[model samples]
Target: MGLDFSVVPEYAHFLWIGVVWTTVLTVSAALLAFFGGILFAMIVLYAPRLLAWPTRFFVWLFMGTPLLLQLYLIYFGLSQVGIDVPALVAGIVGLGLHFAVYNADVIRAGIVAVDPGQNEGARSLGLSRAQSFRYVIIPQAVRSVTPPLGNNLIALLKDSALVSVLGVAELVHASQLAISETYRPFEFYITAAALYYLLNLLLEAGLRAVERKVEATR
Candidate 1:
């Protein structure tokens, strides 16, 4: 039938629940990713060679793997080892961990983008390397990285849907459930797509604002 509204009057309610869970997952994962990325980038930049290389390797491994596979490993694979991480935790951690690798690389490049002249100038003024980095280099690098960082956060928001496989009840999963129960796939899916578009629109607008603030500081 054409646009079967009566077939699934409850679809809106189910989708609302999905939207809430999706928002929760997206926000939680973004926070973890941001902090983990900063930590990983710092280690890659400043740690001893031995420590740095291994940390770099870890970043590389996570970045190279598919987020879906990582989620499976954390959710199902861990259970095989008796680790039993909660699905919500696994989803957020998996998404955040994956995003952190890419974010770390972006942040590292931002740090490198800072001029050698700035470091040398600070040295000439008798600032130690650590002092120069803290007082001079990092703040500038962080500002430079903000735009790419926001982009990664948007990616994180969309990718959070992958966690649905673990039964995390996010937006996609909710839509799927509604489709099965009501047999109105087109309508439910179109609604889900609209919700995602709205989410992304809000995210992009917010990022643009943050990007402007960061740029203004420079």
Candidate 2:
């Protein structure tokens, strides 16, 4: 039989909604992971021994496990214990937390890449420790941080597909629905692949633009 794409219009809405859910998952989780990572990195770098070990344990726990397993524990394991989390919330939390550990490590490396003397110099100039970090250290760290951070975000975007296993109705799920009904796996799957690729390209472009803008300021 010759290939036909007439069925695409019939499922356009499904694809559109899938795109939206995928975006929501990626954006929400990215923000959570990014900001949460900063705090975690700070704790690792500066927190007293009383608090730092526990934070390290948290990071280690997430870092050592597979993300899919983490999502299962959050979404299904919790429900087994009578604490039901909605699908969207589960995806966001699972992806956010799993990636946060990795981001924290990347951010910590970036922060540490700055010379120790700069930090001591800032303190010597009479700026409070927090102010010195906020003004001088972080800005300098951004130069080192942006590339790896962008890579993490790109990886996160691809990982969003894994959430469909939890029935989040993202692109892969939508493609599955189309395949089931129309028995046109190639068309739908190809479409989904194309969408993912295009999104990755756009994201890379955006990250590059950001990197260039940051460079301009340097």
Candidate 3:
């Protein structure tokens, strides 16, 4: 259907607020997930079998489960066990952890993609293990993984909407509230979808720019 100018004009400010919330949630969640994922990736890459196996299990568990179910478990299921995390915290942690699991694999692949000879060169230079990793291996791995990592980040941005179920007042939540009051399902949902699309488009463009910059430095 055509754009509902009447509803759009009336709710523009409200929708802008929702977009801001969505951006905040997405960026915060992405940062959390990236750090967590990198930590997990390091463990899997360098830790002993004993440590790596459990880490692997965690990655599998989070990656295997549906994100929506994970959110519910954190927000609702935990409350059943008398562990009450606030809705916002649960939402951020759930999505961040979930993305971290998948991003771990991508990171692992990036590390693996780095030339084995580079590690050898670092070792031959009398660099310690940590030095070698910090200066050589990780740098290349990051370059190799930038595209995939950015894709995961963008996915995380869109997935933030799943947290709306917990009433986080994000974009989807704002749209739902508007729909409830205005009784305009089509307008609200279509607007929400368009906003999400715009978000992804902008993120993709940013990632492309980053990729180019990284490539130039290489």
Candidate 4:
């Protein structure tokens, strides 16, 4: 069938709403995953054996599985156990948990990359372990991990498409609906892809600005 551009103007508003939801999901999931990753990294690095083992297992379980399966388990499988979660909530949680595992590794590597001497110097100043980590270690680690975190943010934005399966009405889901209604899959999907590309470009620019600002402080 010949491609039709006419549907573009008619369905632009519908797709715009999808873009907003996609942005919301991506931001919310990124923030949730980032903080969770920090906590997981801390637990793996400093917690006692009992706590560390479980935390490591949590990371392994999520990291080893496909994210699409994770989303299904949360959104659909949970309903089987009489625990009903909203589609959007499930999508956010699933994405957050899945990416948090990777984020934990990035954060942990950043923490490890910081020189041991720095922590020793902090301790020599009579700082407690917690204080040394807070004042000396975390600052350095955050700077080291900023780029990886930015990359993860972009990945999260793209992965947000998976949530469309749950009927979350994000970009991909909206595109699917539009195509089904108008039989113009190419037009809608291409538009969705372009929007995603535009978002990633903006995200990359913002990340570069943040990276420069962080470097200035160093």
Best by TM-score: 4
lDDT of 1: 0.89
Highest-scoring model, lDDT: 4
What is the Cα-based TM-score of model 3? 0.92
TM-scores, in order shown? 0.89, 0.93, 0.92, 0.95
Query: Taking the tens digit of each residue's C-alpha lDDT, what string does model 4 give over 140-212?
Result: 9989889989998899999999999999999999899888889888999989999999999999999999999
C-alpha lDDT of residue 182 in model 4: 91
Against the true structure, candidate 2 reaches a TM-score of 0.93
Ranking by TM-score: 4, 2, 3, 1
Q: Candidate 2: global Cα-lDDT? A: 0.92
Error of 1 at 29 (Å): 1.0
Question: If both were scored by lDDT, which would come out higher, candidate 2 or candidate 4?
Answer: 4
Query: Model 2, 57-175: lDDT tens per residue?
Result: 99999998899999999999999999999999999999999888998999899899999898899999999999999988877886778989899999999999999999999999999
lDDT of 3: 0.88
> Residue 79 CA error for candidate 1 (Å)?
1.2
lDDT of each: 0.89, 0.92, 0.88, 0.93
lDDT of 1 by residue, 1-218 (tens): 58966655567788888999999999999988877887899999889999999998999899788999999999999999889999999999999899988888888898899999999999999999989988888778878889889889988888988999999889999999998888888888888889999999999999899888887777
Candidate 3's error at 109, in angstroms? Answer: 1.0
Q: Who is ahead in lDDT, 3 or 4?
A: 4
Q: Note the residue pairs that clash in candidate 2.
A: none
